[model samples]
Every structure is written in C-alpha cells, then in structure tokens.
Target: MNNPAPASPSPASEYGARARAWDWRRALAPTGNVGDAVFRAALFGCALLLLLIVVAMFVEIGSNARLSISRFGLPFLAGREWNPVRGEFGALPFVYGTVVSSLLALALAVPVSLGIAVFLVEQAPRALARLLAFLVELLAAIPSVVYGLWGIFVLAPFLREHVEPPLQKALGWLPFFQGTVTGIGLLTGGVILAIMVTPIVTAVVRDVLAAVPVSQREAALALGATKWETTRVVLANGAPGIAGAIILGLGRAVGETMAVTMVIGNRPEISASLFQPSYTIASVIANEFTEATGDLYLSALVELGLVLFLVTFVVNGAARLLVWSVTRGTSGVARA
Candidate 1:
C-alpha cells in the first residue's frame, strides 16, 4: 500500500510545523516592545535618582557659597585656606585625610572580616553560625551616630590609652605612627571605621561563601582535601565576591559622616602621622556645610561634595567590573 502513502503527512505534523513557522515577528513584537518599555523605565528611574542627588547636593552648597564657584575655580581644590569669613576654601587637606583614613580602614577591616566570615560559614556549627550572623547584622543596624558617640567616648579613649601609644612606641620609625598618641586622630578614626565596616564585610562574605555549592565542597573532600584546603579553594573561587564586599565596606567607610566626624577630630590639616588629627570628605561636609557662607565658599564645598560622589561612584563601578570579571572567568574555567 506504499506505506499508506507516507501517512498523508499527518495534519497534526503539518499543524506543528505551521505553529513553529508562524509569524514570529508579529507574535513577539508586543513582548519585545514590553521588554523595551520596562528597560527604558528602569533606566529613567536610575537617571532620575542620580539627578535628584546631584541637584540636591548642588542646591545645598550653592545656597551657602561666599563667592561664585567659578570665581575660585581650580584653586578651590588646591588652596589650603578654608576661611569661610574670608571667602576662601580649599579641599587639599580634606581630600588627603579622606583617602588616607579610608585606605587605612580597608587595610585593617578586609582580612579580619574575611577570616570571620570563613570561620562562621565553614567552621562553626549551624547554631553558632546563625548566632554570629545575627550579631553581625545587629551591629550593622546600629545607627552611625551611636557608633560615632561610642567611638569618641569609648573607642577613642581606649586607643589613646592603649593601642595608639603602643603602636607609636613600637613603630615610631614609621611616619604614619610617628606622632604621639592622640585620642582623636586618623589612626583612631581608621580603627573606628574598621570596626564599623567589619560587620558589613562579614555578612557579605558569609553570604557569598554560603552560596558556594555543597557538591563542590564534597568533591574536594572526596579528592582527599583537608577542610582548610577545600575552604581555600572554594573561597579562592569566590575571591571576586569577597573583594566586592570589601570594596562595598570601604565605600561605606568613606561615606560615613556622624561616627567619623565624632572620632576623626575633624582637623583641617594633613599630617604624616596617623596619630595626628585629620579630616575626611564626609566629616568636612558635615562639620562645615551648615556653617559655610558666601558664594565661593559654598561652591567650593559643593565641589568637594561632587568630588566625593564621583570618587565613590568610580570605586563602586570598578568593584562591579572586578566582580563581573571574576564571575565570568570562574564560570568559563568551571566549564572547561
């Protein structure tokens, strides 16, 4: 029967073929349009938020400038004088203090936080892990003002009495530790910042480590790896995430105001010694913004705010790129 005429190319098969070949352009056009609309909406929202922050910062500063921002121009950033009454404003010392203190905070906080996160996630029992996580989160939720107050009264005094003096005595040869123990200084501020950022890094790194697959750990163990070895490999694999978390903590430290202002001593001078008092961008803004008067003075302050915002944005963007690269590289290596 000629194989039943090839089953007459069954209608169901034809229908299926037709469905697959249907006007995809027409069918997907609406969906594509909807997706585009959503993307545009998100983009617009982000732009709006950025615009709002920028405008607010400018407005706040413009309202306080002693002279027009254009009048002082580039000198505003390089000029050392900051006399508002004289309509003079310079950001050099503040910038110096800001960057140095934040870097110090990162140096102190990152490793400690990583260690804490690794221990909590890999070594601690579930009960202990949960407890630790809760505590860290609680620390994070504490207001910045409270931390500042505590830093000034409790931490600064302790550092002045114990930590700063000992370090200065031991590392007196180093410029950073050359000065005599001052309770409120760059070192003290850095220490407080480290403490403030520790919980952030720990929480982030813990989550990152926990996200690692159980099977990967099992495979490492099956291959006769020690616990530390497995953790090292797994953590190394998650290095990008850990770095991003540290960067995030750094950003937080850099932008912190109240706590830092309280402990930083808010000195408007740059010094080689961490033991000497210093100021930061946030502290400068917090301490001076309210008191700033005159167009040029106010503009200079606004310009400082702009610099801080840009610096933060750049750092965060770089961190995201680093994380992205790490994730992409790891996935490719994993597949290979």
Candidate 2:
C-alpha cells in the first residue's frame, strides 16, 4: 500500500519552477538604467536647444541693431523723435504705446479673467467648467490677424457708435478720455489686446486656483466663512500666482503686432488721450519694417525690435520668478 513510492519531483520540473520564479528585475535592471540615462540626456538636449535658440535670437537682434546702438547710443530709449527721412530715430513713443496699451489690457483683463477663474474653480459643475474653459481657451487660438480684422470691421465701429461716445461724454475732463470718438487708438488697441490676452490670464488663474488644496477651501468653510469668503481666502493665498498670470498676459499684449497695427491708427507719438492714434513697438515693426529705406531707418526699426525684446524679456522673466515663488510656496505648504 506504499502506493508505488511517491514519485520524486523531477529535476527538470524543479529547474522549470525555479526559472518561473526568477525576478524580471534582475533581468531588466540594466536595460532600465540605460533607458533612464537616455531619457535624461534627451531632456537635457531639448533644454539646451531651447536655450540656444533664445541666445541665437538675441545675437541676431544685436547684430542688426548695432548701427542704431552706435549712432543713437543710450539716448535712443528716451528720445521722442522718430523722423525716418532725416535718419533720426527715437523709441519713446513706441515704448510708451507698448507700455500703455499692455497695461490697459492688463487692467481690463485681470478682473474679468479672475472672476471667470473663480467661477470655474469654485462654483462650476465639472461638465460646465470644462466646456466653458475649453471655449475660453479657444478664444486664444484665434489668430491675431483675425482679431485685428475683427477689430477693424466690428469692434472699431462698435466703439465709435456705442461705447466711446459715453466714455468721451462722461470722462472727457480726464486727460485720457478727452479725444474724439475715432474708435482706432490706444484705447481701442487696449480693448483688442485685452480680448486677445484674457483667455491666457483666465487659464493661468484657473490653474492656480485649482492648485489650492481642497483642505484650504474646507478650512475656510469650517470657519463660518461664506462661499465668497472661502473664494477670497483661496484667492488671497494665490495672489502672487495671479500677478504672475497678469504679467504674463501683459507680455502677450506687448508682443501683439497685427491687431494693434491695424487698429491703433499707426501714429507714432505720445498722447495722453486714449482716443488719439498711437504706435506700439510691435506695430511699427510690422507696419514699416519692409518699407524701411535707409540703413539708419532699418537699424532704428531693428533697435525698436530689440527694445521690445528686452521689455518682453524683463516682463516674462519677472512673471516666471513670481510664478516660481508661488509654486514653491504652495509645494511647501502641501508638504507641511
């Protein structure tokens, strides 16, 4: 009844079981390490490429602007005259227009964008939030030329007929609102720029608000806070991020060309009146770069481009720093 001595496990079977039990980690670790190294190197290369491109752009702009830099010197920035026929150039008006228009855009865009962000992050149902957010972003995808054309045909007339009249009537005493209802000026340019950049500001603010932890909102609510109060608390915490968003949008406004050129009336002068025609750095470049006749004129335009590049660089750099600081703070809070 020793039911035929229990068959001993086969050596082959034992070896097969051992093979089945073997760890893939031991087999694939070297390959994974190689892959990781390759991936890291690829990322570094891409970063290097981006940096090189920026450096190349700076070099190209500097080379082209060299004559103007030598002739005009540092005063080119503060000088107000831009007589192309006499070979004299100054950047102040372009600089002023760029600054004023971008600032106006930011002023007009920030409140509305922030409100939209708040609604999307705090009050909206998921489906509605996504839909609205998508639409908002789609607004940004429209070409600047399209916005410019729309501004010329639609917005400019609308302002002339409806909006600017009231502004002129009510605020005419103010230096900014005193001019005729021409509908194509710094004010109109600002409005177009605002519309163009609002989506960017909104999207950034929405993302910043979303990053606010659920617990922060819950704590705000737990403290007998109203919904608006909770939102305010969250917004206060994210203020630096919002500033960065606005500044980033300002940078976008500063760089806009076609829309501003088409609707800004292309007059290169510093005027307090919002209704007066003005020229921005980008607008000048877009409008006159091809027609630039003399070496100095071309160089001046290139120098204007250089100035614009610097301004955008500074604004965007500051924005990045602000956003970085906010992100670091938020991450620290999350870890804590």
**Best model per TM-score:** 2
lDDT of 1: 0.77
Task: Give the residue spans of candidate 1 off by over 4 A.
Answer: 1-69, 72-75, 321-336
Q: Tell me the lDDT of candidate 2.
A: 0.86
- The residue-level lDDT of candidate 2 at 154 comes to 99
Query: How much does candidate 2 score in TM-score?
Result: 0.85
The alpha-carbon deviation from the true structure for residue 93 of candidate 1, after best TM-score superposition, in angstroms, is 0.8
- Please provide, for model 1 over 1-336, each residue's C-alpha lDDT reduced to its tens digit, 9 standing for 90 to 100: 134423333445555655675544334332324565567667778989999987887566555443445677667678786667766677788888888888899999998988898999899999998898788778888899998899989998898898877887788898888866779888878888888888987876776677677888999999999999999988987888778777878778888888889988887897999888888888888888787765455567767777778677777777666555444433322110
Clashing pairs in 2: none
When superposed on Cα atoms, how far off is each prediction in RMSD?
8.8, 10.6
